[model samples]
Target: MARSETESERLKRIAILNARLPRTRAIAQGVLRDPKGRVLLCELSYKREWDLPGGVVDPGESPATCVEREIFEELGLSVTVGRLLAVNWLPPWRGWDDALLYLFDLGVHHAGELDPALYLRREIAGAHWRSIADAAAHVAPYTARMLEVAADAEHPLYLENSEPGRTR
Candidate 1:
């Protein structure tokens, strides 16, 4: 087995590397179902692929707030941010060793009709409601795991990947 660095050491190394690479913050919101099984997702502009609704977490903002704000901004719908679902640490790159992914469970307040035209202005290529099964196949495995955990109802805030600097 590979020896793992302590959390403190990881933090120190991350701090040093963060000084060089551009730092960015983002929040991914999983808009959950009320009693039924459904969620909201959007296809990103850069990837032009399907993904959860979210965006860069602004400066001096909390992850929960970021998720709520990002969802509203991207989808034009009201959502209530719930408990933390996952925190995925991305792999090292270009003198930078980590990226924090804050995934949150979303309790939608007001649902809206699908409108493909609005997303063009936001640089969002796609947006729609997805059944849990459909979403599981569309997202990354780690993200899929999060959806599995969130939809179970019995388990919330489950952490599937633990390696701090590793990608799933």
Candidate 2:
């Protein structure tokens, strides 16, 4: 027979159970377009191809907040993160654990809005605004898919393995 638990004991047990629940790493990426409708891609020093202007979501941080923070940190630009464009589930790849990527629309930017002399963080080698075709050539496979979906999506898309599918 099981003994009844006190209130404190029950709370502690609940906390333990919560702690043991599986967790997934999250990446928040921003989609920023130039006036000519080209997407912005950043070249990172650590990777061969370009990527969006965002990073891993910190613990206790919201996806939106994480994207905004990462963009500022990487590009030296303060951006307003808009509607969620896509949520993609990535299986473990390149030694990384499975992760959920949240892509948010950062809206379009005018040519004059960007300062040419802004110092990019050391992690970022350069940045460019390229057409979707050009962007696809420069970004990773998953990122390329996200850009394609975001460009045509009238509503948010849920993707699995970089393709649209039923959500788990």
**lDDT tens per residue, model 2, 8-97:** 999999999889987789999988898788888888988898998899999999999999998787777899999988889998989988
Clash pairs of candidate 2? none
TM-score of candidate 1 to 2 decimals: 0.64
lDDT for every model?
A: 0.63, 0.85
For every candidate structure, what is the RMSD over all alpha carbons to the true structure, in angstroms? 8.6, 2.5
Candidate 2 stretches with Cα past 4 Å from truth are 1-11
Question: What shift in Å separates residue 55 of candidate 2 from its native position after superposition?
Answer: 0.7
Model 1: per-residue Cα lDDT over 1-168, one tens digit each: 999999999999999987987765444565555345577767777663477777667878887888777766766666778777666554454474455677766764323454555454546767656776888667766556666555544434434342323335
Off by over 4 Å in 1: 1-26, 92-97, 108-117, 120-122, 153-168
Error of 2 at 148 (Å): 1.2
Worst 10 residues of 2 by lDDT: 112-121
